[model samples]
Target: MAWLLLIVGGMFEVGFTTALRFVDNFRNLPWTLAFFGSVTISMGLLEYAARSIPMGTAYAVWGGIGAVGTVLVGMIFFDEPSTLIRVLLILTIVAAIAGLKLFA
Candidate 1:
């Protein structure tokens, strides 16, 4: 359950970042609200999950999910470059996240 929350938190991390891009330095009210709400939920969930999961492992996984999700969002929605090397590297991060879970 903690792991599930951690994953959800990581997804919210992605949401917050995406919202950030639309905020126009905080001038956009709706997206600014989204950014803050997403951040609040993300942090709350991370804090809760950290109570059970090892801090280092939880943090690494959370960060990995955020990074990978954000990159994919950029690629799929924003037309960011998706070079072969970039994707291969992202897969390694996914593998590392899985490895942490497996060995934890």
Candidate 2:
């Protein structure tokens, strides 16, 4: 299923970003490799899913997934702020993603 691939790809987007934080400007060999590997799979799946999904919708959804996921990762693992407005905005992104999926 294209949707499955897209969701999984989005998760890989999270993986790549998390790994990126640990890369230390590419000096950390393991994290660097993990970043590249995850990104490769993420993009590959996005590329494939785009064959069926509309390009604009697919790209927007992909970015939304990445943005929301990265922000959550930051707050959870990096002790980033979890202010009310920030969380509300993140929920908006989620709503938008859901809207796109439902309307697509």
Candidate 3:
């Protein structure tokens, strides 16, 4: 269940981060609301995940997942770079997240 929460938090993190550009420096009310809502949910779920998971492991996994997810979301939706280097970096983050899960 903690892993589930972590994934949920990651999803929310991706949402908020990707929405950041659309928010237009907080001038766009709808996007601003979405950004704030997603980030709030993400933090709440991260706090819940920390209750059962070790702090270092949970934090690393959460950050790694969010980072990778956000980049993928950006590439897919925002027409950001999808270079081979970026893919390799994302793969490394995935491996690190898996290693942390296994060792945790």
TM-score of each: 0.98, 0.96, 0.94
Q: What is the Cα-based TM-score of model 2?
A: 0.96
Error of 1 at 93 (Å): 0.4
The residue-by-residue lDDT of candidate 1 on 1-104, one tens digit each, is 99999999999999999999999989999999999999999999999999999999999999999999999999999999999999999999999999998997
Q: Write the per-residue lDDT of candidate 2 for residues 34-66, one digit (tens) a residue.
A: 999999999999999999999888888888898
Judging by TM-score against the true structure, name the best candidate: 1
TM-score-better candidate, 2 vs 3: 2
For model 1, the local distance difference test gives 0.97
Ranking by lDDT: 1, 2, 3
Which residue pairs collide in model 2, if any? none
Residue by residue across 1-104, what tens digits does model 3's lDDT show?
A: 99999889988988888779799879999999999999999989999999999988888888888899988988998799999999999999999999988888
